[model samples]
Target: MAFLGVALLGLLAGAAVMYVLYRPRFEELRRQAEAEAQRLRESAQAQSRELLVQAQAEALRVRNEAEADIKQARQALLKQEERIQQLEERLARSQEKVDRKLDDLERRERGISQRERQIERLHREAEELKHSQQAELERIAGLTTDEAREIVLKRVEATARDDAARLMRQIEQEAKDEAEKRAKKIISIAIQRLASEYVAELTVTTVPLPSEELKGRIIGREGRNIRAFEQITGVDIIVDDTPEAVTLSCHDPVRREVARLALTKLLKDGRIHPARIEEVVEKTRQEIETIMREEGERVVYEAGVQGLHPDLIRILGRLKYRTSYGQNVLQHSLECALLAGAMASELGANVQVAKTAALLHDIGKAVDHEVQGPHALIGADIARRLGRSPAIVHAIAAHHFEEEPQTVEAFIVAAADAMSGGRPGARRETLDLYIKRLEALETVATSFPGVQRAFAIQAGREVRVMVQPDAVDDLGSITLARNISRKIEESLQYPGQIRVTVIRETRAVDYAR
Candidate 1:
């Protein structure tokens, strides 16, 4: 026990000594740890304070932005409310205006109803008054209403007939005098103003060769060159015993012209092969087309006609090569246009319409060989299809009397056509025969009964017969026309056909003075 006590004392003494020896060091370590902990706590406190400051700054910024947004929202709400209020006010005003309109309409409707009622009552009174007056007249006249009406009607009819006949005779005399003077003056003026020369064109064009040996070369090994030339040019090549000349025969003047040019070029170039022929022909075709276009442009400019379609101008150029009765068709058209313009200016008509119609009057002849119709109608259709005015189309259609000339311009165009085609040396028609035929037509028409006067117009194609109204009634006029036509058919051996037209006219005139 004593040893154990001694050991325990020693161990306790040793533990005490060790504790005393490490106490300062342990205190220094504890102080260092505490200082570090204090430093860490201070840093944590500083960090927390910084974080709190940043959070507060962010909160302030967010709050300011939110407040600004809320302010904008509030302003928008206020503006919207103000707009709504204004709209309400406008709607209220509109409602008031509509209400006033409704009231006005109601008043007008009531007034209209009253007026209708009053009108109905007035109509009834008027009917009664009319009936009473009619009865009183019948009683006083010692005749029924029917008998009085018939007598009055007969008297009026007789008086009107006498007045109408006198007026007709007077008006007809004045019209004839004025019309004859105007017609003679206009015709003379138009014919004097426009002078055109006639150019005769043959269907066949002769190409002169340099020598006979060249002809053999042109024949080109079994006539291949000639065959190629014919096929390309759409023209018939006539190589006969005509001295050193080859004839080009074609119905189409344009084709004939092209063939002539191509042959001339080939003869000049002295290259008589199929390939050379094709090249020469193509080059010649282009040259001819250019010439046609230039001619068309020149003629159109000369005629002072503008706004022609490209295709129309091209076709017009084609007319340069076409000939009608020894007259260049394009030249004839130009002359017609000038004459028509002069007449139209004198008569105060549409000069442009007249000139354009006259210019296009023979346009159908350009394509007449292709289209199957009268040239007048075909030309009219072409003009109409190409956006021409109705007056121009009508003038073209009426130029040949295919349709009746209705407008003054149409008549002017027809007159221009007649003047152009009937002038001396204009066509191949014998003037003596034309006059004789016209005289025969007039004689045949005037031989009919009740015929007061007979006039032959439209190149002896139509006879206008005027009948005495007293001698020939409407039905009698028809019969007279038929008889005259039959007599003309039986007596005269005319070409084509003759149109016999009978006219019976009535006129009523009154002098306000």
Candidate 2:
């Protein structure tokens, strides 16, 4: 028991010594822990304070932004309210103006009603007065009402008839003027399509021989070759002393051309027998017929004419070698066809009929030597025989006034013929004759009453007369123009119809100083 007590006491002493040694170290650790906790708390408090300050600043900024937005919204609302008030004021003003207009309209309506009532009263009074005046006139004239009415009716009828005649004359003059304008426009357009320099007459064809010795060979033995050539080709072969040339003359240009060509070939072949000459002449005649046929077709195509009989076409081809007054008949015919077509189109006439008639108008001249009548009449007969329309036949016949123009196309064909034949350089004429014609036209125009001056223009196609305005009124000018035109038709022998115009002009002049 004593030993146990001694051990216990040693244990207690050791514990007490251990506590004394570790208590200081434990207290030092507790102090360090407390210091770290305090340091942590201070840092946390500072961080929280800084966060609070930042939150306060953010709240201030938010509040300021919200207040500014509210201010802007209030300003916008105020502007809207001001605009609405302005609109209301404008609407009120408009309403006032509408009310005023309505009142003015009512006043005007009342005034109009008063004026209508006054007019009705005045009309009734005027009717009564007119009746009374008519009765008084009947009583004073010692006539019954019926007789007075009949006389008045006759006077009114006469006056109306006079007025109607005047109006008819005015309308006719206007129509004629319009027709003349349209005709001139169409003629001008047609003339622009062709610009022929001059017509060349073909009477004789001269064949050039290569050598002077060839002429003798052409004459052949004892003039036998020349005689055979003349008999076969129907042309006179003139073996002149001229160097290296021979002339072939014939009234028939086609025969003359064939003779010339045959003679040329004979000389080239160096064969001067009657058999060779016959063969060459026959071949050349065939070639010429072929050429004429081709020329006819070409002319027909150019003129836009169709549906002609073959015989008519052949006859038409012969016009290529025919000429009148130094003008090629074929070219003149073509020009006439074109002019007629253009004028017919303008006048609303039959264009085909016009063109066909104009083209075939001179076809008779091709065989005029064989026919016994005028070329126009012969051409008309030929056209009639060739299944042409009566209108075409008439136009062809009337182109030279052999027959009176009975249709619009006939008149157009005549006018086209005149235009083609009357153009400058189309036919051979001396300058003196042209000047005399112009002077005659002027003289005819000046012979009219009230004409102060006269001028012949458009190559004697038109005569313009200047009349004294004081002497000739509008109606008098028309009468004067008719008189002048009639006088010209009676006195002048012009190729084409001359247009007589009377011009009455009034002028007012003022000077500024």
Candidate 3:
């Protein structure tokens, strides 16, 4: 029991010592924590004051900027109101000017109306005075108004008839003179400018041989080579006494050309056999065809014409081998084209159409052997088939008067053809045929009734018929001329044109007292 009491007292004493030591340390820690909390509170208060000051300054700046914006908007509105006021004032001034113009127009209209009424009154008074004067004149003339008018009209009729007749004669004379002068001038100019070579192509082509020995070679064994050449070329080979020359006679110019070429080549090669003749003839034919095409192109280029069909050009080239009355058809065509183009330019016609028509005028002669028609009509058909224009086709057809010339270009082409054909040395006719034509023309003219005498002048171009004055009056003479013309046209196949003239004159014989 004693030990237990002493142990308990020792434990209480240890506990009291521990409590005293820990209590001082706790007090020191608490004082430190309170001082830290106070310092943090003071820092927070200072930061809050600074934030409040920044906010106040920002609010003041924003208020000032907003007020400035409102002031600018008010100023802009005031300026817009001033502009509106100025526009309104301008509109008012314009309105005033318009009103003044309207008032002035109204005054002018009123004045015009008054003047019109005065003019009408004056017109009525003048009409009344004219009627009174007419009545007075009728009384003075001792005739009724209608009778006096009839007399005056009769006098006027006589005067007018004489004047009109005189004027008609003068106008007719002037027109005839002017037309003749112009025609002569154009024809002269055309002839003067165009100085083409006159070509006289014949149906016979003469081939000159190297020697008379060649003629015998050409006429081979049993004349078999000559027979073969003729059979192949459709040409007649005539070996005459003429030295070193053989004649190739064929109506077809192309065959004649081919025969001439073949003969010349055969003579050159010195191999005149039947087989060789046939071969050489064919090669010559192809060469001639090439030559024809080249000639056609040459003429087309020389004429400055374009867009001709290949087939048409080939046919035109064939004209180079053709001859009409001893005139080379191709040269004639070129000459006519040049003449027609010149006349067309002077007359304001289509120059290209005129030239093309003239160039192709004798195209039918190329194929006339195959086709059965007049050359002009056949050429027109060919042109139509080749897609030539209607104007060109018409000109081709009308060149020979087979068809009536409708356009100026057609007439120009016809005139050019006449000029080319009628010029001296352009063509030739046999002397016998020429005489027969002139005689036929005179006979036809004399055949008409009341024809006293007839003479063919101007190289048979014109027939002058003198009629008996008693049998044929002026009107009958005109009828006789027309009849003679119609008869000549129906019966005669003449070149160019023929003019028929009838003359009638009456003589009243009375001795002067």
Candidate 4:
């Protein structure tokens, strides 16, 4: 059994020997395979790293390209915006030019259309007139148009005189009505605003004496007092013409007043000597100077004159001894100042300035007889000399209408002067017109075409013409009166115009009253 176990062990030992020899070869092969497997893993890791680097580089390049493209696009957009703005401005300018052209075209078209219509209307009217003339020519003696027109002209000319007279009368009446209405409004307004007396002065004045024997005292021994009185007063002392009175005849009112005072004093003192007359005259002169000062002071108080120069005050005093158109110069100036002040107050003018100018308006009258210039210029020079303002001097100069009024105050002074001086019967003319005034006025009224009878009424101040009612109506009476007035104004010269009145009476007398 031992021998058989030994043979099996030897066979197993031989097989183990063969396995150990092949184990070396197998180990070598395993080692080589492990080495190849490790190398392949390393190569794969390196290739993955290179591929990651290439992808990172490509992403960076793409990012830079996108930024450059965005910048170029912004530039292109800015250029397009500028081009659009330029196009819009050009369009706006073109629209403005078109609007201007359209406005001009519209105005031209309107004018052209009006001219075309006028031309067409005139052509149509001319055609109608030509046709009418042709028909008229044929009807009138079968003559040509020119011959017919000439005959018609001759016939029209024959009646033209009457037509012309009627047309002239109508035109004159229309113009006169308009002018009279305006004049009446002005005069009425002036008269209503001004308050003055209606007293009119006469050329002759009567001085009354206490007794008839006083007249003998007025005439000194050898009639020297009467002669001296006439020479000093420049008046005709009609002592013997009337009974128990004496008539003062002088054109100057100031001279007449002086003579009256002198005669009155001589009568009161019962003096019949020339030396006593001379002494009375000196006293009368002083009294007149005092009266003149009082008159000037009264006017200043009434006119509210302040801040006047001493020279101006003296000139104001001189105005008392002057006369204008037989009216007292101081009274006239006072009335003018009142009127001017009232008007200035109404018109919002400088009231104090206007009153001062008006009060001194007639200052030139005090020296006009001695001076050689117009009253207006002389008064202005006086005012300027008295330290008056240029405006006041201008107003004083323009009061007489000798110079044009540049201000409202000047116009007011002129208007007031006219209102006071232009009243009817305000002044009397010289040269003893008493010779034939009433007779001449009556004769002038009867010279009209339809005047039947004339009577001088209102103490020869107004003449009334009685016209036949059937022959002359109220309008014709007025026309006849105007004709008579024109003749009287031209032919017969008299003092303080004689008013001509025409009376056309249509009455049925029953004597019931």
Local distance difference test scores for all models? 0.86, 0.87, 0.89, 0.78
Residue-level lDDT for 352 in candidate 1 = 96
Supply candidate 1's per-residue lDDT for 94: 100
- Residue-by-residue lDDT tens digits, candidate 4, 1-513: 999999999999999999898999989999999999999999988999998999999999998998889888999999999999999999999999999999999999999999999999999999999999878868876787788789999999857755665676688789989977875665566567665675544333778888787677677667887887787667678888566899887755556677778877777777657677667777887787778777778888877888887667766877765665577677778877877777777667888878899899888887786688998889899889878999889999987656778998888777767766656655554545553777788888887777789998875778989998988865566567768888987787454457777889899878766
lDDT of 2 at 130: 94
- Candidate 2 is scored at a TM of 0.54
Query: Candidate 1 — what's its lDDT?
Result: 0.86
RMSD of 4: 21.9
Best candidate per lDDT, number?
3
Q: Which ten residues in a row have the lowest lDDT in candidate 1?
A: 195-204
> Which pairs clash inside model 4?
none
* C-alpha RMSD for every candidate: 16.0, 17.4, 12.2, 21.9
Tens-digit per-residue lDDT, 1-513, candidate 3: 999999999999999989897998989899999999999999999999999999999999999999999999999999999999999999999999999999999999999999999999999999999999988987787798788789999999978766766676578569979998999888888777776667677655889888898888888878998899999999999999999999888878888888888888888899889899889988999999999999999999887788999999999999988888888899889888999988888888899999999999999999998889999999999999999999999999999889999999999998898888877677889999899989999989888778999999999989999999998765555556768988998998776778888988787889988
Rank ordering of all candidates by lDDT, starting from the highest: 3, 2, 1, 4
lDDT of 2 at 203: 47
In candidate 2 the C-alpha lDDT for residue 247 amounts to 87
Best by TM-score: 3
Tell me the TM-score of model 1.
Answer: 0.52
TM for every model, in the order presented, reads 0.52, 0.54, 0.61, 0.51
Clashing pairs in 1: none
